[model samples]
Target: MTPYQRWTLRTDATSYTVRLSADGPWAELDAWGPHGVETGPSALDWSHRTHFFTPADAAPAEYLPYGLRPFTGADLVASRPGEERGVWWEFAGAEEDEGALRLAFTDEVLGLRTVLCYRTVPGTDVILRWTEFTSSRELRLERLDSAAVTVPVTGPARLTYLTGQWSQEFQHTRLDLSRGTFSMGSTQGAPGHAYAPWLAVQDGENGPAYGVALEWPGNWHLTAQAEPGGFVRVRAGRVPHEGAVYLTPGETLTTPRLACAFSAEGLDGLSRVWHRYERHLSGERLRRPRKVLYNSWEATAFDVDAAGQLELAKTAADIGAELFVVDDGWFTGRADDTGGLGDWYPDPAAFPDGFGRFVDDVRALGLDFGLWIEPEAVSPGSELYAEHPDWVYRIEDRPARLVRNQLLLDLGRTDVQDFVIGTLDRLLTEYDISYLKWDMNRPPTERSRPGAGPADRLDLDAQHVAGYLHVLDHLRSAHPHVTVEGCAGGGARVDHATLARTDVLWPSDNTAPLDRLAIQYGFLHAHAPHVMSSWVTDAPGVFDPRSRSLAFRFVNAMCGVLGIGADLRHWDADQRAEAARWIARYKDVRDVVHLGEARLLGSPRDVTCGVQYDGADGRTVVAALSTGPLDGAPLVPGRPARLRLRGLDAAATYRDADSGAAYSGAHLLHYGLPFAWSAAHDAELVVLTRE
Candidate 1:
């Protein structure tokens, strides 16, 4: 969606495919073709043809990031380099190593560039980041390491770890990247991880989904997918095969990275249907209006009453919360544990009047109505379960361990799919609900169906995962107007594919200020701030209990997605006032933060984390958060150090987060002042106004 004519960027770990078609009402740089690939314009005729599913085919048509595959004819067999199938998109511009190409598809429909090697031979790594802008932002491949990374996805089906020759897998095309130890060829048992046959990359009604038929060698998971800003990765082990594989020095493992520029859950799953979906995303960018909002569950407990919900909603609307989302606890039989899932109808006992009244009340306060749904989960204790106990998935003979007392519904099955789609479709039409938070609570486990052969080596993980993709796809198409927020045990399934559907995502369940400081730091490295959900919790000392200053909240809220989950209706006057104040402040600058460059001034390990935003007119906002007294000690006595900032307007005026006193960029940054927090003290957000 970042304005580009047509561009393809690929690396050892991933590839990017971007295209610009007819822009509505307005079009900026007109697209020509896949003109920027170094290898030449690839024959997209195959892409134009109805793609057939096979065990092997090495082309990069629906391949992510860029449409270029990592290797082709020459890459397959180093011995017969010239004999390798060569396809070109463009080859017009070149200077030996200059990154540009020409293409036969070089018409007015697309325009793209390619960055073939991340490590143009490892470490003297090549990059497209510093290139001259082509009316589009530059793309780059970065290497972020293992322990420093978190799982990426918005639901339960997520890969805890990943490794590779881990780049591209085009069905039976027999990918062999092995000149410098870059090859992916496994034997019968140790089948390498990959999307079998093909992966469907589609833009659904709400977001995007990379669908795979998922017949693979071994049980696997969708480990990670870091988009836009990109990610650093680790590889998974593959069974070695009989071949002269390539190696990059001592780097023994290899991997194919998931590409994105990604994330989404949609309201109606309209984007899932190929024809309508193609028409939906053929041309467009995500459109959003600024909104202040609040969510429950982060507030009070699961035992929320209509009164409790209404109390929170009142405070939410009063404090400018646009979409009042009542998180969890609305369905019949849903109390603490998820025993009564799939019962979408409201609990008539909880409120004599139904959710219609809840929607009406929220609307009365000038706010939109939002609800949460985990439609993919079915509990053994519910009426749906009593009617169809077999619908719950678990291996036969093995006691089904109650994961939150709920079982994952098989979206891959026709009857199950119909049931889920029916339940959600009815809700969309029945309620005037404007927003939904789609939660997936799936974990890695046995996915035994009613009659699927147990010894058939079914990739239950993959199939269950496929079911999730199907459910999300179906729902998004069903409700296009209802914005969804994806949550997977909090942060389990935070990835690029989910982002295309929903406007925001729950970054992690771990909201401890110190932990979140680093947790969110890594999340932002690959994702836009707007997709993240940030809020204040009981991080002692981050905010004075009676200060009425959401200093910590503003720091977390300002960066990406913003929300306060703690029960606000129970907060003291000061806490409530503080929350309200921070909410208002963000309303003033959300646009600037949402659309600016985010610069990390230091490593997340430091006692203090620094971030800066350089907006269009040179307006800069520098935010810093105190992690904690490093090594269990206080730093209150540390010197008032001056900070030399990056991405700052060296000439802009700066203001203190506390005093509002102004200082020139040169004066404040020149003197390195240590952060001013005691014990587990506060964090700060500073905005710089350029004159």
Candidate 2:
């Protein structure tokens, strides 16, 4: 391991070495596959090799620059009191933990102490990076960035990121990395749907691909700048939206964790590495087999009541739904999005006998019960809001701005935090609720507290997230049996911080099968499939007008945690029977589909796109969808060709679950399976078991 240098970090497949330069300190990356970390003598030292004409100590114009240097392109940016020039950090030394490396630096002039942290796990190729800042005297920092790493670029390079808006999340976009700064972030109080806090740069058409993802749930920023040399400096951290954090003497501020992953095998390889790291943290694939759930949101939005929910539960149970969730309109005065947010109590008129009988009825139908709750928001007309006027986020003199006719509950306050936890605790304790759909319908607005200015409100943003997580942690600890699904009006609050506490995530409010192909595709690139909860909702979709067959919808939703949000009562006998069969098939192969390695077969934007799931055992499942004209016309000239399966045992004999035809895995992989579906938006699911 390169003799275990004091200022070096190594993952299973990569090595990052740092050194003190005349201008500051910089890091160079070398990555290899499973063979091991590459620490050969030929490794280039970019710090002092003089990539530019300027001397390293003479105000670095090239070479590699860091927070410790006098450079404009610094990875870390900060300002302290009484500093005429920009603050420069000096390397003090380094320290090593069990699986982490820490490099310490200090700016004596500003009485600021900085430490950069890098960590790695055994099976992952990701290097986790973050920065810690401490001050001896009180100071205000304009900006504090997490650790930054310089990646070598060769030939042409491209930067790929995900972007979307409400109802349309996780749309992957790629742009070539240019000379200037390329950046994307969330200025909204929370991580907005416009962009996910992640970025990737692929250097050369065939060289290694490196990526970084911020683990913060609040507003975050990431920037990539191409330097004079063939290197790109990337930095990411929490965004200082209000500017200037007033740091107390003994109070230390740590930036959000920024994780970097490297793969010599390109974007797919890097994506898989990230997937493994996420799975390692979430236990996503190893957790109890995900249930076939039915959420009654699209079915009965604001009309949730006892008799209707009971009928829906019966229909859902008949179709093999293991969990029945009643979404929205369950609480007092909650007829729509405008009212009854903070009041967690059941509506006396809607549920005349309370939720006890409904819960029992659902449980009797052989399905687990779940309730949807939005703990972080309150309507202005809610009784809770009327009672606790100071609980919501509000400016001192300005009137509160309401989104969806609801104001954000200030979890930053201890009392507000207690109320949220207490209400959830009471629900779990009273009812037989196995799942809780924790939701945040709107982003925070008018976030300033009564006495705190805008700068101080920045602290509220961070604290609210912490408080949100604190409540989740307490819930998980107390109700160990209940599983939580995190939602922000569907997918806005998806990040490491939220994923760590929740069991599943709603990728988007838009569940149209055709659109979901692209949405789920982008989502699975970072998050594991098991943690993604996709539903087959009623269409004529809310977002798109493309009418898809139920079979196509089933396969799309089955790719993740299979769910149904369609109104079962409106379905005909044949449709219900077909749904029952599909649900049965999903349950039969869910082990492979939920816990196995996922492989995307084709681009979602193309005429044909599909996914392959390979289990540790000898089972494999392939779900393919045709987006082009399939009925009478061919997308191409002739009929579609066969689809070759992936990650199968080539020598083993396999049997098709439907046809019961036996074939060699080698033949299946070589000759490929026949593509039967020809109708537009038609999907096919094939399950193969080794014999």
Candidate 3:
């Protein structure tokens, strides 16, 4: 803990002033921007960075393109004709209610009281909650620095270059109204479209914005607006898209709203976040991924035929996978998607003696055991539904629309909460489950209850908010060592909110690494690599059929979760051997891939992009991407080959990461690497460890 910094939030003409205590742990966090903030002053920053914007800042013509359009001092004054509206300003509203500082602000749109409290938890955390609310839509954020409460916005979403002789970084960040959503953070994208909001940080290896863009704080509750059924529209970066969202008038959007605690740990996360982002943007391949894990969803879906999934798990373990996860379909009578939700009990028919036996088998194979669950949802046919028909969320008497034949259980209700927590508790107690895959398949809008009043008391818009946090808190406490992941209908709800709660975030269901190349690029720009979900991907619709280059498939999933979703059962000896080698590579550098800084060398949408990773051993994983014409074969020449990097140590040894080729020079060079490729192919994973 450093010393001396009292931050006072105030209003300014264009942006806000976040003055840090002169004699503090950090120098100062002063930034003059139109969006959230950025970490670097280089194009490489785009590798691991994202931008933010709100509806308030969108229409302001002066702040066109809301999120990241590069700003000049002259443009600071409100250049648009309209008085920027919406929840435009936020700051420390009240003194600590207990040990916590209580902050208050209005959502502007719904005129709802959005109060938040932050204070150290005696010896542990700095707790924050959005309570004492008139509207059920209270906001809660986590991972805030218990000590500091202010910082400045700079980098990406703001000015491309510093101006007005200003060079203050956010020592502590407080919100202010600007051209877009916040007073100063005009980091907005298309208003009425579905998008996920992202926050980016930088690390080394990945250039500039190539640090940590960690999304999914924990469990998030998100909504777009105050009106019912309005989709939330939050975008990250220069139009690269990640997650599904939209905006409308009726719904109120409530995000995870996590308070980033800037400790030494945060710096590492920040670095990894940017690195992952850069990798995706550059369309680089990974020599290794964070978790040497495998997912069973692709191999078996909800139809978890014991032998089928078991074989997949066996292959994953044999390929040096550290964790084996049976995604979906393990619960009692839940053999398929049509049934078995809400029934937390393990299915004896599926696992015979429950997961305990499977766990023993996987452990014997030197792999950890993991389970999949969607505790927040209940199947209409499940026993829990039969017993507690009133617990599912609904608008009282309105008819329910079932997704995957299930209904959402309201965490706001204690009984529902108890049921979920207890079920999870029983599972942990009964089995040696080390991981949990928390999935929410439906986007809740129309709130309902079996027998509640007509008045809207259920935080309908905040369902995701309250629902997710409740689960996170329980899992964190009851199963302290277990790793939890947030997966919402693939990658729809991936944002900073859920990042705080879980260890990782499953980016999306689209496993085609090429598509994932774009998806991961967009996701990394705003979230952390530790949690990005992907697999030894396959094309979208094709099943049991024509195989694309397995190497290309390997390259695609290498950067993310780095597991195989393709039916390995169908793979013969040669293909299996190749898959094993890829997994072996991932096992070698998985730590660096998951934790090191990432740099996006080029645009994923372009004909070329490359991802590079740096390690202590001078290890680097460079994934080069070429969209059409060239397959990800190696070294295609004639295409522009000069590579610009971000977040590098700048003075490290170098070599041909793949071919053992040598480079004779200083690690830092203004001209970057030579312009050449092995051959113009689709993708290639180039690994170079400095000897």
Best by lDDT: 2
Candidate 3 per-residue lDDT over residues 437-532, each given as its tens digit: 887776444455545543333334344356557777778777877877777666655544455567677766666545556666655544545567
Candidate 3's TM-score reads 0.65
Clashes of each: 112, 1, 130
**Local accuracy of candidate 2 as per-residue lDDT tens digits, 1-691:** 2322334566777765555443334333433233334456423244444543433322212122233354436554455555553555556777887678776767787787878777886778777888888888777666677756566666445888889998889988888775768888886767778899888787755567778889888878888777666667677878754655667787798878888888777777777777778778776325777899999988999899999999999999988899999999998898888899988988878888877987998899999999999999899998998999899887778888888888998887889989998999999999999899998888777767775544543577677778888998898789978889999987898888888788889989888877787888888877788789999877666555667799999999998899999989999999999999999999988888866778787676666677888888877888888776666344345555566766577889988888998878888788777665565447889887888
lDDT of 1 by residue, 227-299 (tens): 2111111122221121222222222222222222111222112112211221122123234643666777777
Better of 1 and 2 by lDDT: 2
Q: Quantify all predictions' global Cα lDDT against the true fold.
A: 0.47, 0.77, 0.49
CA deviation > 4 Å runs, candidate 2: 1-8, 22-37, 41-44, 47-72, 82-85, 452-458, 541-544, 632-638, 649-653, 661-671
RMSD each, Å: 15.3, 3.1, 12.4
TM-score of each: 0.61, 0.93, 0.65
lDDT of the structure predicted as candidate 3: 0.49
